[model samples]
Target: MLSQTTNAATQKISPDLPLTAKQAQLVQHILAFTARHLTTAGPAVFALYGDAGTGKSVVLAHLFNQIQVAARTQDASPFAHTENYFLVNHPEILKVYREIAGEHPHLLKKDFQRPTSLINQMAKDTVHPDVLVIDEAHLLLSQADHYNNFYGDNQLQSLLTTAKVIIVVFDETQVLRMKSFWTEARLEKLIAPYPHETYRLTHQFRMQASDKLVRWINDFTHQHLHPLPTDVGANYDLRVFDDAEQMRQAVVRRNQEVGLSRIVSTSGYPSTLDGGKHYITEGEFHLPWDQYNYTSTPWAELPQTINEVGSIYTCQGFDLNYVGIILGPPVSLDEHDHLAIHLDRYTDVEAFKKRADLTDPTELVHIKQQLILNSINVLMKRGVKGLYLYAHDARLRHYLQQRAL
Candidate 1:
C-alpha cells in the first residue's frame, strides 16, 4: 500500500505529541520564563532560534498548548485566565495550525492568526493579550507594507507593545524577501532593551540524511560546491540528474510509490501575481508554477498540485517524502567552481522589492544574492527521505552529475 504523505498526523501540530529530551527541556525553560515575567514590568521576549526542520515549530505548538491548558483549567497556575494567541505570517502554515486547533479542545481556531490580522484586531478591540507566540518570525514585515494592510513600522515591535510576553521562532537562513530581511544583529538590537532570553536548537529532526550529506548541502548553499561524499546516498536517496525531464519522471514515480514527492525550483523563470499560470520550462520538462491555493488544505497536500511546480512560498515550512529541485537560471557555477547568483535572471519581483531603509548599492547586491541562496536552501531541505537535483546551467549540471558518480 502506498503511504499517505500529507495526512493530518504528519502535517498537523498536536500538543499531546511527545517531544525529544532537548525539546522537552526547552518547554520547561519557556514555562519558567513565562511564570517569572508574568507580573514583571515591561514585555518579556523569548526567542527560539533554529534552522529549517530543527523542530522549533513543534516546541512552540506544545508550549502554547500547555499555556492555554493551564490558563483555562488551573486556577492556581501562573497563566490562569490569561489570553494568548499564536501568530504565523505564512498563509499555508497558518492553515495547518488552524486545522490542528480544531482537533484540540483547548486550542481554538481564533487562537491562531496571521501577524497582521492579530495586530489589527488587537488595536481595534483595545485589548492586550497576555502572551503571543510567533512562528516563522523571520517572515514578519520589518517595513510598512501597505499592500498587506500593515501600516506599522515593524510587526515585531508592534506586537511587543501590545503583548506582555512574546515567544518567536526565527531562522535567518530562511529570510527570502527584502522587506522582511533580518540578521542576528538586527534581531538582538531590537530586543536589547527588553527583558529577554534566547535559545538555539541545533539538532536535525527533519531529514534522515547523514551528517556529511547535511554538511555538503550547507556548503553548496554557501557558494561552495564540493564533491559529494562516498556515502552520500547510503542512508538517504540523493541524486543529480543531467536532464530535467528525467528528474521529473523520477519525482512522479516516487510520488506514486510513497506520495508527497514533488518538483520545486528556484526563481529564475517567468512568474507574476496576475492570477494566471506562468510555466517553468526546461528543455522537455515543463509545468506551470503552483497556482493560488484557495482551499483550506495546503498546496502540498492537494492531489492536483503534483502537476505544478512548487515555489518557496508554497513549500517552505513543510516537508516532503522526496523532492526534485530544478536549480533555475539564476543559479550557476562560476569559473572558480563556486556557485554564482545572477540577480538579473531572477524573476521573483516581490522578493527584490526596494527597501527605503536600505540604499547602499554594494550592500543591496549582497542582500539580494543572499536571499536567492536562501530560497535554494529552503527548497533543498524540504525532503524528509530523499532529494533530487537538476540545474539549468550546463556547467553546473555537468559538475553536479560528475560529483554524483
Candidate 2:
C-alpha cells in the first residue's frame, strides 16, 4: 500500500524545513558518501547522529528525496546502485513521515520485521534496494517482534547484512524503553567490522538555540541544583507557567496563527481512550494525549489534536510551532534548592523499572533520576518556534518562572 509521509502545511516533511549550515553540510556529506558507495559497491554503513531537535529527520527527508529523484533519473545519474529505502520503527513517527512523503511511501515498518522477513522478502523480490536509509534506528529491537512472531535477535546486524549501504539516523538519549537494541556500545559492535563513517550535527536548527541556551539546558537537566539561568533569550520563547491552563491557552492561540502546535507532558502512561477521548491527567488540569489503540495514530498532525495532548512517545521525532509542557508530579525543586525527580510520582514506571531492580538501591535512584530528567529535557527542545513549560511542583514552577523573567 502506498502511504503519504505528511500533509502538514508547515510541519510537512520536506527539504524546505529549516536546516542549519552544519545540518546541510551533513546531508551533503551523506549524499556524497552514498554515491561513492554505489560506485565501488563497497560494504558500507554510516551513522548520521544528533540530539533531539537537531534536525536529524529533516536531513533524513532531504537525503531520502535526493536519492529518490536520482534513482528515477538514473540514466543520467552519478551512482551505480540507485535503489534505496527508508525504514522507521515507531508508528507515530511513521505516520508523520507518511504525511510528509505523500505518495512516496518508501517506509518499512520495523515491528512487522524479523530474522527471516527481510531475507525472505529479498529472496522473493530481487529489486529490493541495495541501500537502506533508516530513521529512528535506535528503536530497532534485539529480539523478535510480537506481531511478526518470527525471530530476529539483532535487527541492526540483519540490516547491515541485507543492504550494501545503510545510513542510520540515531539518537542515544531518545531510547524510550528497554526493548531498543541500539546503544553506543552496541552501535560500536554493529558497525565495527563494516566500512562505516560517522557524521555529527550539534546546532539546534529546530529551536534556533544559542550556545548559552543549550549550555543552560544541559546544566539544569544534569542537576536541578544547577541554578536555572535567567539569561535564556527571547527568540526561543521559553517560559515557565504557574498554571497548565494558561500555558495551554497560549498554545491554543499560537496554533491558530501557526500550523503545528500541541501540549505534551513528561507523563508516560498510555493515553486513556474512553468514549472516544484519550485522557492523561486528573483534577483541574485535565489533559489528554491523542486518542489511540497505540502508536499508529498521527496525533500531532490532526486538526482534532488541538484538544488532545501528547507525551514523549507521540511527539518525539515530530516538530511543532509551540510546545506546552506539563511537568506533572514527578519533577520539582526541593528545600535545598535543587531540581528533584520523584520516581513514585512519575507515570512512566516502565522506563527503567527492570534496570532499577537489577542495580543496588543507591545506583537505582541515580538511573531513574537521569532517565526521567533526560526524558524531560528531550521534550523541552521539540518546538521549532517556542517552548512553554507548566510544572506541577510549585517550588519548581516558581523557580522556573523566576528564571524566565
Pick the lDDT winner.
1
Give the true-structure RMSD of model 1: 1.4
Per residue, candidate 2 scores C-alpha lDDT tens digits across 1-405 of 001213553254565576667767878888888777765654688897888766678888888777776766566776434656677776677766655665444432332232345555665675455777788787776555454443556677766665778888887777665446346777878789877899777767667556677777667667735545555556767777877877888998888776578888886444333446555653466766655634444767666677877777777777777888887778878898877778877656456535222447786677567667777777887787778888777888887777665
Name the TM-score of candidate 2.
0.82
Which consecutive 10 residues in model 1 have the weakest lDDT in total? Answer: 1-10
Candidate 1, after superposition: displacement of residue 359 in Å?
Answer: 0.9
Instruction: Give candidate 2's error at residue 277 in angstroms.
Output: 4.8
Q: What overall lDDT goes with each candidate model?
A: 0.89, 0.69
lDDT comparing candidate 2 with the true structure: 0.69
lDDT of 1 by residue, 41-100 (tens): 889999999998889989999999999999899999999999999999999888888888
Off by over 4 Å in 2: 1-6, 9-12, 16-25, 39-42, 76-82, 103-127, 147-150, 268-278, 293-297, 349-368
